[model samples]
Target: MNEHVPDPAAKLEERAKRKAAKREVKKTEIAASTLDALKQLGYANTTLRDIAAQSGMSLGSLTYYFTDKVELITYCVRLYKAEFIDRIEKSVTSAEGRDAVIDAFADELTRSMTEDLPTHRLWYDIRSQAMFDPAFRPVVEEIEGKLLETLTRVVQAAGQQDTSAVPLGYAMIDGVFRFLLQSRDRHARDNDELMAIFTAILRRIF
Candidate 1:
């Protein structure tokens, strides 16, 4: 009689699944703690050691979990970009017509990104850091690509294909973003007004 043995392929698949689940958990923990560190230390000052300490993990552990600072920042960017895009897409898709859809999309986007002061601060940190560092440029570009992709799709769906409108739309928000964070401290209430004006621009272009 031969001893029973587990199938090797099944064993490997189970191991892989477990590894993936563990990675997901670690990613969540890292994200939460890293964001907290970002708040406390700001973008340029925050280090991997700080994040590891906050998360109650060793630097080696964080290294195993993330390739580098760029990877971690990219994760944060992905989270924000996804939230922004999801809200805008939902509002636009659910609206009755082109005008309403564009307006609602703008409103939702502004509402999501600036309704919280911390969110605006975090964005300011990431965008500023990306501008000076070679390591972060790709991450910023990737985030920007995702952002513009969402806007472009929405604009096209609304019945226009002005390639220039993509950057123009971006400029409108960038101007508002700069004004909010730099020219003056932004309040939550300003979100509604910003959204209205942005939508007005999109409506004109589209």
Candidate 2:
């Protein structure tokens, strides 16, 4: 029997991989805490120290993972919005028919608005910041592009051959959601109204 020998390079590579994985886990935890803070305070008011306090981690530890508030916010928002997009995509794709698709899409929007209001508010706050600060525009545009692509798929599923109205439909949906976010009442009545308008818009596009 020959004795087995561990290669130094392989051992070093394995250690590096473990370190990276641990780093990612820590970053994710920090991002979740930052997201909570951002949701409550919005982008304008949130700071790195606030994130550290929220996360219960020392400021030095937090700064080691993320350089500043912007980097932290970028990571949090990207992680969240990617998950958000995946949810809407699943809802739209799983529906059985055109009307079902429309209803699913509209219901998901209503659910997000009512249940995840803080997250959406934080999203809108960051988006508004993009208007004034060029640094945030790239992320905003990337998110918007994904949104429009999903809307286009919805329109196509509704039997619309001409996809020219996708942008208009997206605009209408966004406008309605933003407007509803302002209302104090998040009752069923609000949901019904939004569903009606959203369904009507989809029907008109098709």
Score every model by TM-score: 0.82, 0.88
lDDT of each: 0.76, 0.82
lDDT of 1 by residue, 9-121 (tens): 99999999999998988797789788888877887788888888999999998999897888887787677667777877777786766787677877775665565456558
**Cand. 1 Cα-lDDT:** 0.76
**lDDT (Cα, tens digit) per residue for candidate 2, span 1-206:** 98899999999999999999999998998889888888788889888889899999999999999988777887888888888888888887878777888888778877777678888888889899999988888988998999898888877776667888788878877887777776645544577777776677667666
Which ten residues in a row are the worst by lDDT in model 1? Answer: 180-189
Q: What TM-score would candidate 2 get against the native? A: 0.88
Off by over 4 Å in 1: 1-6, 161-164, 184-191
Off by over 4 Å in 2: 1-8, 185-189
Given candidate 1, what's the lDDT at residue 52?
89
Error of 2 at 24 (Å): 1.8
Q: Considering only N, C-alpha and C atoms within 3 Å, which residue pairs clash in candidate 1?
A: none
